[model samples]
Structure formats: structure tokens, C-alpha cells
Target: MNILVLKMGGSILAKLPTSFYQTIVALKQQKICEPIIVHGGGPEINETLKELHVESKFVDGLRVTTNEVLDVAEMVMSGSINKKIVANIQKQGGTAIGMSGVDGKTLQAIPIDNASTLGYVGQVKKVNVSWIEQIMEHGAIPVISPIGIDGSGERLNINGDMAAAAVAKALKAKLALISDIPGVMENVSGKEFVHEQLTKEEIEEKIASGVIYGGMIPKVRSALNGLSGGIKESVILNGLAPEDIKDYIQGKQAGTKVVMKKEEKQHV
Candidate 1:
């Protein structure tokens, strides 16, 4: 069975419309093995934090998770978003269970200061796939919230992209990031600018050449990390499009295919 780990970007999650659910329903008709959904709740998290009168900060895209902010993140991610995603899956005729990175110590972590300024955020140190596999084996999807446990047993909020990559690496699945736009654009000047396909090396070169910058840098970087982390392949794909999952699973070119040294088409 082929496992597919999907990371839903936070930018789209707060407003992930019914169309996204429809696409998951479509995947139900495919040959996909276990499809684990790892989701982000950035906008929602910020919104909730604001309502609670908490100020949020970030360094290198990771939220500065002080204890107060950590409380809110855990509530929003574990209690709110995870359930929402699982409910959507069930409504679409697929069974899914909402869980946290801490469930059965599924994802163990360590503090990631990436730079001296960042605080409390975690980088995945380990992932225990048993719980995830147990759920998947029962024909149930696991909706994972990126909240992990640190070295000292403290709970930490990890970045969704990094969390998804770690989970993909643990399962050695085909990882996919579902986003609002088409994949990485190459031509830049036209509508079809997005790469039909590209090797991770080619992608790095584009970033170095300043062709891909800003928001896209992280998106591509996350995809590359997933590929290098142990997944057979990974993608940056259009999340809102109808049946996007089915399209990519069938290699229909709906978004950018982040290659593994070479195209999967040439694989043995």
C-alpha cells in the first residue's frame, strides 16, 4: 500500500472551502493506500490569539511559542482544527481520527532556536509511526496537529511543514503539500509559468537565481525537505482545484512535481 502524507498550508486552512473536502472525497475513489492529513492553522491560530489578547511573534516563520502562546496553539490546533479536518473527512465518506503529535508520543521533539531569537518552537527529533499505522490500518485517516513533545516532556508546537515532512519520512510515504496556488512557477511572465516538473536541485538553483523568492521559498523548501527526508516523492500542488489529489496521484500535472533526482516516470 502506498502512503501519502498531505500537508495543508495554514494560509488556506482557515478558509479551506467545501471544494477541498470534495477533493478528499475524490481520493476515496482512487488506489491510494493510507492518506494522512497533517494540517496547519496559522491564520486561525493568530485570529484566536488576537481574540484572547495575546500578541504573537515569529522568527524565520516559526511562531515564538511562549507558554501563553503555546496554550492557544494547542487549543486551536488540537481541539479546533484537527477535529474540523477529521469531521470533513468523515462527511466526505472517509473515516478519520484527529490526533496530536503527542498522541502516544507520536512525534518527539527538541527545541529549535534555528537562530538565537526564536524560542519554544520545535524541530522534529523523532516520529513513532505505530499509532498512525494503527489508525490507517483500520481504514481511518489520522488528522495530525503539529504539536509535539520536547526532550524534557514539555509539549511544543512544531511547524506544520516540518511536522508533515517528519511524518512522511517516518512512513516513507509520498508527501504532498496542498496549497492555494499552482506549483512553483518558472516562466514567471506568463500564466503557464509554473514548472511542469523540476528536480530539487533545479529548484534550489532557481531560488539562488532569485527566480523563486519570498513565500515560494518556504513552500519549495518544505517540498524538498520532504523528498530528502525519506519520502519517495513530494509535491507542491493546487489545493482548491476540483479533484486535485486525484489529478496528482494519476500524474496529471495539476501542479508542480518536485522530483527525486529524476522523474518518477523513469523509475524502475
Candidate 2:
């Protein structure tokens, strides 16, 4: 069974073209691959929180999730955003089930740090792969929200990238981080070129030299984490491109492929 985990970033969700949904449909209906969608809802959560007069703040990109904040996060992530993705896929003739990591303990996590400043943010410690596999076996794509449950059964906000990485590792599936950017690009001969393939050391060197900065840092780090966690391959690709997913499924050079080592290019 070929499984491809797609992490759809919140920033690009709204702007994604209809063709993106069509590609997802093709994946399932055409038997291209079993698609698992892990999505983020940061902007929606912030908007909802602002409407409810809840103070919203983030420390190092992780939202500070108090009880009130967690409530709104659940509503926005699981209720609104998750269904929106499902509806979009269904509209394109694909079967999709929207769910949260809290449902059936799909994602179990522990506090990222004991520091109270970051509040209820959690890092994934376990993923209920059986449940996800069941959904896929039923011919439905699981559109997962990143809310997690803790040891005491408290709901925790899991970073979408981290959540996706954990899911990929647990499923032993390929990971594709959907981003607005095409891929990791650098200036060469005064022109920007996306590195079609990258290894851990090369990614680290570029980061150290400030080539891969800002939001791309955590994304690359998350991809690296997936590779280290037994995922065969990971990539950062443009979600807007119609052929990107198809190309990735065909093992073609469509985006930046993340690898464990430079010589481990057999898969790419």
C-alpha cells in the first residue's frame, strides 16, 4: 500500500486552486495512492479567537493554549477547517473524513516543555495508526486536525508540521509538506534555483549560512525529523501546482526531496 502524507499549511489552504482538490481525487479514485491530509488552521483560529475577545499569542510559532484558547482551537481546527477540507475534496468527487487527533487518541502527546509560558502546547508521543489505516481501507482520505490528547485526557494543541511528521513516521509513509513556495531555492549565477534534492548535512549547511531562514527553517527541520523517524522520503512542494502531487507519486523530480544522506538518492 502506497501512502502519501500531505501537510497542507494553513497559509495556503484558502488560496489553493480547485485543481488541487482534483489531484487529491485522482489519487484515490485512480488508485494513484492512499492520501492522508494533515492540515493547519492558525489563521482561522486567530480570527475566531479575536472575534471571541480571547487574547491570542504565540511563542516561537507555538500557540499559547489556555483552556479558553484550546476550546476555540478545537472549534476552528476540528469543526471548521477540517470540514472545509473534507467538503472541498468531496466536491471534487473524493471520499474524505474530517477528524481530530483527539478522536480515538489518534495523536497522544506530552507537553513540549514544563514551562508554563507556552501553555498547553504538546509534542506528539504516539499516533494511532490503526485508526488512520482503517479510514484509508474504507477508501476515505483522513483530513486530520492537529489537536492532541494528553495522559490526563486534556486536549493539547500540536503544531501541524510536527503532527504531520509524527503521522508520517508512524505510517512509514512518504511526507510532502505543502507550502506556497515551490521548493528550497538558492541564488546561483545570480539566478534562483530550487535544489531538487537535499540531504541532512546540506540542509544544515544552508541553514547555518542563512540561506534557509525564516519559516522555512522549521519546515526543513520537520522534514528532517520525518526522515530520521523512518519515513522513506520527504519533500517540500508547491501545493498550487496541479502536477506536483502526480509527479511526486510517479517519483519524478517535482519538488525538493529530503533525504537522510547525500548517497541515499536511490529513492529520489
Candidate 3:
């Protein structure tokens, strides 16, 4: 089966129209591809922390996860945000199962900094794809939260993009990183146009030339990392554009396809 891992950032989740979920359901129902959702809850987690009067800190874009912060993060990501996405899919007539990486040891991880500077932040050391496959066998889409478990049985906060990339690599699936914008855009003679496809070397050259800057640099880098880790391909897609989802599935032009090499074609 053609498997597509969709990574949605929390910032855009709330703003995504109901049509987004419907498109996903339609794709699965049509057997276009097996779609798995891995999501983040950054904005919601920040809101929850603020409401609870907990101090949130960040170092180099990673949240400095203390025990207290980890608790809130898990509560928001695994508890609320995870179910919301599942419910949205169900409402669109799709079978969906919501879970955290801690469930079934799906994402076995180790602390990124040995629990010193980054505290409970972890990087995925291993991915158990069996459980995810089992869920898929039941005709349900798996909606995963980024909270992971360490070998010592400690729950660790994982970067959502990193977690999603790990799952894509494990499944050997194509990854679709849903973003607010259409895709990576560059200015040519004062006109901006999205690059339909990019390679690792091109992406780096664009970054160095300031064509890819600010927030997009990290996103493209994440896509490059997924490509390097054995994912067939990764694309930056617009969550707001539901039609793009179908376009991507049908092997039609839609978003910016990021590949390891210039001549690499999408397996799906």
C-alpha cells in the first residue's frame, strides 16, 4: 500500500477547515493511500501552560521540558489535541485511533541531553512499527501525539516534526508536512513563486542565498532530514488547501516535493 504520513503542526490545526478532514477520509476510503497523522500541540500546550501559571522556556527552538512542563505538554498533546483530531476524522466518517508514542512503546527514545539542559526532551532512538501497522490493519487511521517513552520508562516530550519524520522513515512512507503557506517560495525578479520540487543540495543553496529564510529554513531542513533518513520523499503542503491533498495523492502537482536527489521521483 502507498502510505502517506501527514504531519500537522498545532498552529495550523485549529484553523484548518472541516474540508481538510473530509479530504483525508475520502483519500483513505478511495484506497488512494494509507494515511497516518502525526501532530503537534505547541500553541495549545503554550496556552495550557499559561493558564496553569507554569513557566515555559525554550532553548534553540526546543522547549526546555521540566517535569512540570512535560506533564502539561502530555496532557495537551496526548489528551486533548490528539482526541480532537480523531474526533474530527470520525465526524468525517473515518475510523481513527488516537495515541501517544508512549503507547505500545511505538517510539522508544532517549533524552537528547541526558536530562541536563533539555530536561525531559528526548530524541527517538527506535520506532516500533508493528503497533502502527496493527492499527492500520483495523481500517483505522492512527493519529499520533509526539510524547515518547525512554528505555527507563520515562515519558519524554518529543519535537513533533522529529517524531513524524521518525515514523515516516520507519514505514518507508512519503511524508506530507502540512503548513499554513502553499510551499517554499522564492523571489525571482521581484515575483515570488513556489518551487514544485527541490533537492537537498538545492535547498541548502537556497538557504545560503537567502531564498529560503526565517521559518521556512527549519521546515525545509526537516524535510531534508526525512529524505536523508530513508523516507522516499517529503512535501510541504498547505493545510488550508484541501484540493492540494487530493492533488498530492493522485500524483498530480500540488506542493513542493523534497527529495534526496534532483532526479528522484515520488514512489507513490
Best-performing candidate as measured by TM-score: 3
lDDT of each: 0.81, 0.88, 0.91
The residue-by-residue lDDT of candidate 3 on 135-219, one tens digit each, is: 8988999999999998889999988888998999899888999988899998899998999999899998989998899989878
Q: For residues 18-48, could you state the per-residue lDDT of candidate 2 as single tens digits?
A: 9999999899888989999999888888889
Off by over 4 Å in 2: 228-230, 265-268
Residue-level error in angstroms, candidate 3, position 207: 2.3
For every candidate, C-alpha RMSD to the true structure in Å: 2.5, 2.0, 2.2
Best by lDDT: 3
User: Which one wins by TM-score: 2 or 3?
Assistant: 3
Off by over 4 Å in 3: 264-268
**Candidate 1 backbone overlaps, count:** 1
| Predicted structure 3, TM vs. truth | 0.94
lDDT for each residue of candidate 1 in 1-268, tens digit (9 for 90 to 100):
6777889977877556787776675564454556789988888889999999998887655678888998999999899888988888788887888999988899899887562555567878999888999987777888999999976789988888889989988887778888778788766446457777778778878899998898888888888878766676778887777476777777677788787687545556
lDDT, model 1: 0.81
**Model 3: which ten-residue window has the lowest total lDDT?**
259-268
